[model samples]
Target chain A: MSQTFSLAIDAMGGDNAPDIVLDGLELAAERHPKARFLLIGDEARIGAMLARRPRAAKLCMLRHAPGVISAEMKPTAALRQGRNSSMRLAIDAVASGEASGVVSAGNTGALMALAKIVVKTLPEIDRPALAAITPSARGDVVMLDLGANVQCDARNLVEFAVMGDTFARAVLGLTAPSFGLLNVGSEELKGDERVRQAAEVLRESHIGPNFHGFIEGHDIAAGTVDVVVTDGFTGNVALKTGEGALKLMRDLLRQVFTSSVPARMGYLLARPALDRLREWMDPRRYNGAILLGLNGVVVKSHGGTDATGFAHAVDVAMDMVTHRFNDRIREGLSMLSTPARVPVPATAPR
Target chain B: MSQTFSLAIDAMGGDNAPDIVLDGLELAAERHPKARFLLIGDEARIGAMLARRPRAAKLCMLRHAPGVISAEMKPTAALRQGRNSSMRLAIDAVASGEASGVVSAGNTGALMALAKIVVKTLPEIDRPALAAITPSARGDVVMLDLGANVQCDARNLVEFAVMGDTFARAVLGLTAPSFGLLNVGSEELKGDERVRQAAEVLRESHIGPNFHGFIEGHDIAAGTVDVVVTDGFTGNVALKTGEGALKLMRDLLRQVFTSSVPARMGYLLARPALDRLREWMDPRRYNGAILLGLNGVVVKSHGGTDATGFAHAVDVAMDMVTHRFNDRIREGLSMLSTPARVPVPATAPR
Candidate 1:
């Protein structure tokens, strides 16, 4: 536990709202007893929930916010009408230097929009990327632009590489994490000009020794490198596609274990190992999406996630705060040379 | 089996070459006894292998092709230097009307480049798309543009919809296949201009009744639609990412079951069910990548696959030929109004 650390919590976000948010804090507080929280939401509801959890209530400083950003609200609308929203106030705490970071399980678009406008991005960063830590065959891999900038130029992609590199080192505990640019194919001449130019910049950068060249989609789960970087469109698609595949497997396995009496008996015998497997593959273990290149750390937890998942998101925000993630990014960016200008084609190459 | 149906075979394409090709023919021949093959490769090697399977040998006509396209060869280079290649000859047979279709397990880029040039595309089709039938929760899902055209305009996407619709009906035996345009989100305004315009066109076309609107990446495995349409880059990445996720699941399951003695016993008891699950998930059963919008049926098998997988590719080609896939596509295209000219943005939208 970091004795001086504190984080802002958006208590009114997510499906379960104040209940799960308070419950999550109770769990997180047990793990990091010294850390404090500035809980921003409806004071009455939060206070009632906090009363039920005495320890979490003792550690939380409740602040009243009259509005909440609905999950279905558009980013532009949220920005225009969300002055006193819990999500906004929580992020403001980080910008006002009251907290080291902010965590929310609210509307993704709203959170991202507010974070960008309120905390703003680093001076060297053009756009912040959404990075997630996913379990891979080798270990954990950090992938960026999970759903941030849908369209990216070579400069944007190069910036993501630097941020993702810094992220892997801080969170995954990798000393020199190898990163790869995600493309349709691993060849030097496979994708569009933007991808090729990003590869070229990385190849010539100070961190070139840590660059693993281009890698295909399959390399993500294979853990071909420590960081996998791509534009939000492909990265988002790839992320959801992976989730879909995993769900399909789970469904198929359920059918298999229930097909016969022998399978039922086998299920009993294998229950322990199966339990371990479930724990290993649990979504809660990797619940947070860190918005990189932002001036302050902002972690987005899945809106539908339970208390356990929310706790994991809190853990991610704490990790960044304790590790000085922003300082490292600034250092990394300062050490790099700007990528050469390459005219990207209007359309993708054949 | 249609007695008149004969598929041109690239006998020296895959990793195993003539031996696997001949062996695959033997297996495929059993499933379609009336079908004949025009096998193209080194005569002596194919002949010697064909001799081992007398039944297959009797049904095959061997053609000599001294060259082979290496996996690493670029598409342009392959077309330039691989004129006498087995892959090229097989595609040539289709163009010359000597064979109903062509099946190749060669380099994907080379196979695609040659097929597009020699066999040509449908008169109304602007670009050919690679289609694959993947197993899903509800049943099999047909997805297209899996690396055929890197970037696609709205017109290109509309064509893919028509072709994908026909492909699902022919291969999956669906009477009316519902199709969805793949995008980052399900909202009409979620993705770039190309996707929205494609959706608009589909909304007004003859197939509008069958169009299910925009779907996210998870919809591919959810089997929300019978056909999933996307540009080549996203589709290809999604396909490989699914494969990677499945592989990760398998590795994790193995570790889970083998962790303890009870788990091992349970695995044995569940062995029958597990085997069935494995069979259902086997890559060989879904090995072919059909190049849709082509004038003739063309199937690309995995270059590293064995006889069983190759046979599956042949089975796919046979399905297309028997169903008159090209004619169906022409009919589908003729029934629809041309896509309205909507300006597609150069890159995916934020």
Candidate 2:
């Protein structure tokens, strides 16, 4: 709990900008007393906000960043024109070795582009994937390539599996986490050639024993595996669909509880237990989406999140830094590169 | 109601086979009154079950099929060796003009393959898509390509849009249902080339006014559009993910209500209202998945569903038959084939 580390913060990012960023820093400061922050944003504004929060001020050092990246800015445009932006400066800090990690709630496309271009990807990684912890029936499950790569080849999928496995271990503390490649069916012949090829490689690699072959979408929420590997397009859709379904259920539950006087009374009697359910399902508990396979830790918080949610993102970055997530991924990749004991056939039987 | 139309039933299909099939027929018999059924299965087994249901027996003609296709049978194997299977015979009834449609609670892969080969695709449709009704916050939403074609070209997507639009009109009674192509984002340049090309074609087509450019997965449950069109892989994953999330929420709610004595008392008082919510969200209500763009109506019921769920599938087929769903699609396809008012740019700006 007393481990010393520093994270570069994008103070002028997200919807509420400096306010929520500073407030979240205050909460994070209380939790990680030994951790230091280099707040990169408009100096005058961040300085004024820090003046109001004595706790955040004690652990934060203001770094002036005059420019700001808008939510609607294109990734390519942001990279070309956002050299002095807060998001850019925060990432720069990580690249320059001034901070161990960077946390941003800015435009996701811009953040990914900047981090990949500035901080760069790990040597063995083809592409750095967007990985996040999603809620499952049994517990938290990790899913990756969430809109980072719309089209993924077999090699990319194999890399994602390695990164996801290392991620679950470093963050979730799973000793030997089980993972599955997302497919239309659990059968080997379910998906396209690329998916089938990826499955074959995983089945023959170092992680073969822990590989669950293939899993359907329901298996995600059913907690059939600890890590779910998928292409960016499908993963993004599945993640959003899960979120929308949960929202619909919550809405319907609210309507059911307020339908009549008796129903309202029932809600009052069940308030205690219902509150526990609410706490368990809180979106803030799973806010940070790490850009895995990157040379340095990069976490993207939900743009619309509040102080508590932002604080949770910081916690995720801290965990990745302290636990040496990148180092674990490097080890996993090396193990994957080791030749298989039994040579896999050129075209494995489906 | 008295305008008679016959449907072939695969009585030797599903987990509960003849019993649930017969019970479903009895229910459908009451609802349709004058509708007749050509029940295909083992003679002795189906006959005995039908004889017990006086209402179903009064409106049914038994067609004995010697074989039954197991759920695990591969599509190729089913097509090659399952000539006399109840499912095959049922689809054959449609092909031979003995029945207007066919309903089966059998292997989905076998059902789709058999239906494509036997019932055949429409003249204008490049490929048939699997379309199903899903619950949304606003109302029922139609999603397509749930697992028919793993990879689709721009033409296949445009065809799906036209068929989906017609389906909404015939089944959901939405005269001008707005539709959106599912993607990672609503931005023009977000997805692969195929999706972008499909969007351009749809925007220039006859249904252009009713076409929402692009939609994310959450748009399905938000009811932002009536029809959500995507390739088989993503659609299948999104559908199951939504189902899994709903199941998770339901399980959580049950746990909350049974956690303590007061919570149990609260459940009793709120039973009536919660019952309404349960009925509204019942999976049986959305049991049928129609194979769209086919020459004849082909409905696939969930293999493990019970009598009520089977009956719902029958209801969906009946709706398609009575509403002249195929005729509507023919008209829609003609409209699409007509020359556009303005020539779409070969490479439209993103």
- In order, the TM-score of chain B in each prediction is 0.95, 0.95
Q: For each candidate, what is the lDDT? A: 0.88, 0.89
Question: Highest lDDT: which candidate?
Answer: 2
Query: Candidate 2, residues B1-350: lDDT per residue as tens digits?
Result: 23234689999889999889999989888899878888999999889889999999998899899999999999999999999999999998888878889999999999999999998999878799999999998799999989898877777888899999999998899989999999999999898887898898899899999999999988888889999999888999999999999999989989999999989888888889999888888999999999998878999999989889999999999999998899989989889844432343333111
Error of 1 at A82 (Å): 1.4
Q: How many backbone clashes are present in model 2?
A: 0
Segments of candidate 2 deviating more than 4 angstroms: A1-5, A337-350, B1-5, B337-350
Q: What lDDT does candidate 2 reach at residue A322?
A: 86
Clashes in model 2: which pairs? none
Clashes of each: 0, 0
Alpha-carbon deviation at A344 in model 2, angstroms: 11
lDDT of 1 by residue, B1-350 (tens): 23343799999998988778888999998998888889999997778888889878877899999999999999999989999999999988888888989999999999999999998988878899999988788889999889998777787898899999999999999998999998888877687777887888889898899999998888888899999999888899899988898889888888878988999999999999998888888889989999998878899999889999999999999999889889999999888864433433343422
